[model samples]
Target: MEQKVFIKYFSGTMSRGTRGIVFLLAIALLAICAQNTQARVTLENGVKSKVYLSPKIALHQGSVANKYYYDMEFPKGHIAIKSFNAEVVDEEGNPVSLKETYLHHWVAARYYQRKGIKEPKHYGNLGFQQSDHIPAGNAGVCNSASGLSQFFGLGSETRKTSTHVPDPYGIEVGNPLEIPSGYEEKWLLNVHAIDTRGVVDAMGCTECRCSLYNVTVDEYGQPFKPNYAGGLYCCYDETQCKVKNGLESVKRNVYMKYTVTWVDWSESIIPVKIYIFDVTDSWQYTGIHDCLIEFDVEQSTTNECMDTRRSKSSFPIAGDVVYGVAHLHSGGIGSALYGEDGRVICSSRAIYGEGNEAGDESGYIVGMTTCYPKPGSIKIANGEVLTLESNYSSQKSHIGVMGLFYILVAESSTTLGSPVQIHQESKVPIFFWGVAAFGLAIFAAIVVAYRRRRQNGDGYHSIAT
Candidate 1:
């Protein structure tokens, strides 16, 4: 009997030990899983896409066109835009008029600097230097990302009905317009609006250069300030500038949708910087169109439209230029880019809508064509000035308008990393592991409690006998 009892006891002890071993193994696995979950995130290779839009702005009487900037927010890391699209719509998702109504232009860009530095310097007002005056209330945001000047002419110069880009991204597949670290985590979006109502030649007056006004009287003849600083009108006569008080009221909203496709880089890569130079930088706005120089087609007179080179400014750029393009409006003949010593670099010509088409309306001047240079073909050295010779027709009277906007794209030469990339990479791993460790500890505690209960049950059974 004792031998049988001894055997039974031995078997029970072995079974308990085995059960303990199995439980311990499970706990260890749970611990590892918990640790891994806490340590790193499981990632999948794919593209990330999102949509953003500007605030809906109302267009009222005497409003011709308006311009404003929107700062786009994005995650940190190397951000490359694979696809981009912009359009105007009503509340019902229907398209607005392409002839009279337009999203004149929308520019997408980040900040750029030539000299390498540990931290980015506050870019003074976008369109001004340190000595320039900033509107009293506007001084706080003058030259920073929130300031309008840095991205002044960085986007489309003329009106765009719409833009849709398909896969195999330009620059490189999976590669996008990178927003470098240390720079603002925002993309500047410039928006323009136009409305041509109550004008006699809203459609067919071949010669019309609209005059934009600020703080104009509304259709009710009451003075009102628009959402933006100015508005566009097909003003042939100075008398048309006055608000027609009894005219039928018209209201429209400027709506925009921007789609950005990007790749979440496994590791951060060098970013691409965008540089913009507007010919207006050299010319001042006098509010009179005819007084400025012109390229006369009728009298066969042309003006040598020369301005100080952009390189003459403190704007610094290093490294090879990957892509370059120009923005021109109606009456623009073409633009010539020049390096130091008057050597012509490249010329981007304008293509007008000859016959009456949808975008190429009969009377109105339509869009300007853009150009792209071969990768690495154009290189601007530090302190080098680039002169933009812009050509516009003297045959038609055009508003004191823009000439060529030379946009150059290059790799970041600055040392500061994108804050987005640093934040994303540093925190994710720590968070994952921390959570996993907590889970493993909880699981271990449960196992220990169960074992204690089993031992108590055995003792209770022995006493009950």
Candidate 2:
């Protein structure tokens, strides 16, 4: 566009080149007029769904850089923006405001499992039934994240949909290395973030931070970080965080080894927890330990960063293989592995992202899924604090859904003004008249008659680019 202006302006000054300059101006005017005829939808900055309180919503972010990648900073009341290409019409056939609206995204979802617990009843019908009362596999169902897929949905307070897109960086995992004494090697992770139609606000964004610990190098490709996020919050502090530019830095130098707590063990039980939603009937998560499963680790490494094996992988007591699930929260994006001992292991770097909102809008994207020594030998621990985080740049709070709308507007028009306010509807008639006049000018310059799109409605019927 700038080059075109230069040509039109400079060439017009010369006498002999005046005709060519006029021709270029005429072409530009026709293009301008043609766009005005089709221009309609206007994308805004920030527009997203609100935080759902009832029934709870869960957000899971794992691994900021490597598989354990996690490096996102989120504040309360942050909005998300998503863009699409379409027109929205209301029930009365009226176009609602296209500007993006500010929305908040948060996570709090409930899991329902059935556990059988014999409560003190009037008739004394309380007993552990293995052959008759409860069903099979009731003893192995401790995790229920996949079951909550039905209740997944985002909401909007107003009757408007987003038409803006923010730059998003995606991560993919690859290749595993296993060693007996220690593990060492650099792994590869790929990332791609698309540019938004508007200027993206990536404030307070740090590189994806991750840590690898409680590692076990028991089997090839089967190495597990028993505890996700380097044994939860125990081995982590503010000082452990490192920042760099771009997403690839998130996955470098990711490995762990430890000898502390020589054995790793975990269990998850849906012990009969009754919710008195009603008087006669009650809702429960598990049917009396029906979802009870546990996994145990026998060997692990003790060396922190340099060692790839968790010292605990060599569990002292040769504990039985107990399998249960660990959490993959929204803000935290990464993978977990079980050490040869009974400990948990995680990546060394955190997952970093640049967006208006974190995983709330994306809704707890999956981090990692690996098979332990035995597929069903792992178990989730009891009374664990919910630590899933969608950590991102502090910009998430300020950008809001309005920012996405702004991006959409940018994508819609090359000349979209700084303070993007769409042309008024009534002025559209005058806009069309001007377009026709410009088209006639182009026709004169090019020595060709311009066909009226309103009458022909044929080719070249495109909206503003």
Candidate 3:
């Protein structure tokens, strides 16, 4: 006869109170771990993981007169770029635009990568201050709201998911667009002319002060030796800037350049993507007028002459916001992001240069540094309304000003949830503790109920049996 085998069964179920306690503690532990994790997630091995790209070029006066090109040449290797950015600067190294130079057109195109892809085509537009259907790749000279005319250059910031202030000129990377090996890429710059001399002459006010004329530049797009004026005036009047005056000077020898930043893959690292948010999409912006507007907030005056209107637009994606910066012309105060519920997610303050330095003229703004505070992560649901708000000085109207904000967004790997008030308070830990306490309370209630039933005699004893 065949030998028989016996097996034991675990029929006892865990008490509801025990289950609740375990679940709560697990959640609390997971939530804490999420905070320590990085914004990027995962990288492959055997590849050059310690990769970063710092491509920079100088735009001389003669070269930028029409369209100048930078044929990006990389050394022999298996290289790729995950992010790219560009900026323009003056000869003095301060963030500034050439007096008459308004970037007419700019394109970063790639040579054919695959056989069927046709001739070299533009992968992105790196022009100054454009928020069209196409993504923005250019980080114009000294993107700030303080109205300081200078180049603050580029800087790198720590990657974070919390809601903190951002530096506009800070060297930050955006969504990854790779330029694989054997593929050629180039940047083209095209600028037009706006005559400040004519604008001042049309004003015909010997006593009237204008920014465009006060900050004067020579035919070579070089500023005068002594620029006593508070601002750079490229045109004498608004009409000259518009309508494309044939008399305006286009041939100016000025210095401009583009700065590109990205992460090089040499080691394993978490991967993140970038997304853009623009305020020009709203009805408030009319292509009929310049992308930059001048406005007087104190007088509440808004017209073609004064741009007292606030720029507001919706954020496109629903993810944890990792990094961000605001792009504004002179006379800006700060930029903020608001939720559909009217809650402010993160506010980036604009920093201005001071002490009457070359770039930091008295009250003029030179740079706007960004912030990346820890613990406070901001998350928005898909299709949620995230408005970009830029505030500027209202004492006087400004011209050729801009208000654009860009951010990096990442997908969360866990459901630990997002944290709020990290800038002011560390709420993640507190939140976990609170959840755990609630779970403990439930467990206690169950225990008390069971004990009461057990002490109740006949019916309780029968149930137990």
Regions of model 2 farther than 4 Å from truth: 1-106, 110-200, 203-367, 370-376, 379-465
True lDDT of residue 96, candidate 1? 53
lDDT of each: 0.44, 0.23, 0.38
Alpha carbon deviation, residue 368, candidate 2 (Å): 3.6
Query: Model 3: per-residue lDDT, tens digit, 1-465?
Result: 122221011111334555566557757655655643421222333111122122333332212223223234322232224333333344444444323233322224222232233433442222323321122233311123322111111211111112222321112222134443433233233222222233333112111123423335633457644523322234322212221245434432333333332333322333334443344434234422123322223323554333333454444445665566665554667777777887766676666545533344334344555544342267767657566677766556443445655555544542323221112333244445556665565456456555655666445543554
Ranking by TM-score: 1, 3, 2
Please write out the lDDT profile of model 2 over residues 1-465, one tens digit for every residue. 997985564444333544566667767766775675444322223222121111111111121211111111111121122211112222333332212111111111111113343322221111213321221111111223211111111112111222222222001111122111222111111111111111121111111112322223321325435442222121111112222324232221111110000001111111111110010011132222121111112222342212111101111121222221122222223323334342552221222222234221222221222222231233223321111111222211211110000000111112212332222334234456676776565445434222332324465553558
Best by TM-score: 1
TM-score of candidate 2 to 2 decimals: 0.17
- Candidate No. with top lDDT: 1
TM-scores vs. true structure, each candidate: 0.51, 0.17, 0.43
In candidate 3, position 345 carries an lDDT of: 64
- Candidate structures ordered by lDDT, highest first: 1, 3, 2
lDDT string for model 1 (1-465, tens) is 997985455345444655476457657756776665543333323555555556675665434434444234433455444445555566665555545453445555443322233332332114323222121111111133323233323222243422222222222222234323333333445555545555444322122232333225543355533332222333211223234457887777766656555555433433444454455442223321121111212322446532222312223655445444466545566676677767655666655554544445543345444444554565667656667667766554444345534443454363323332322333344445655665564455556545656887777432355
Misplaced by over 4 Å in model 3 are 1-254, 257-263, 283-316, 355-358, 373-376, 413-465
Clash totals for all candidate models: 19, 143, 47
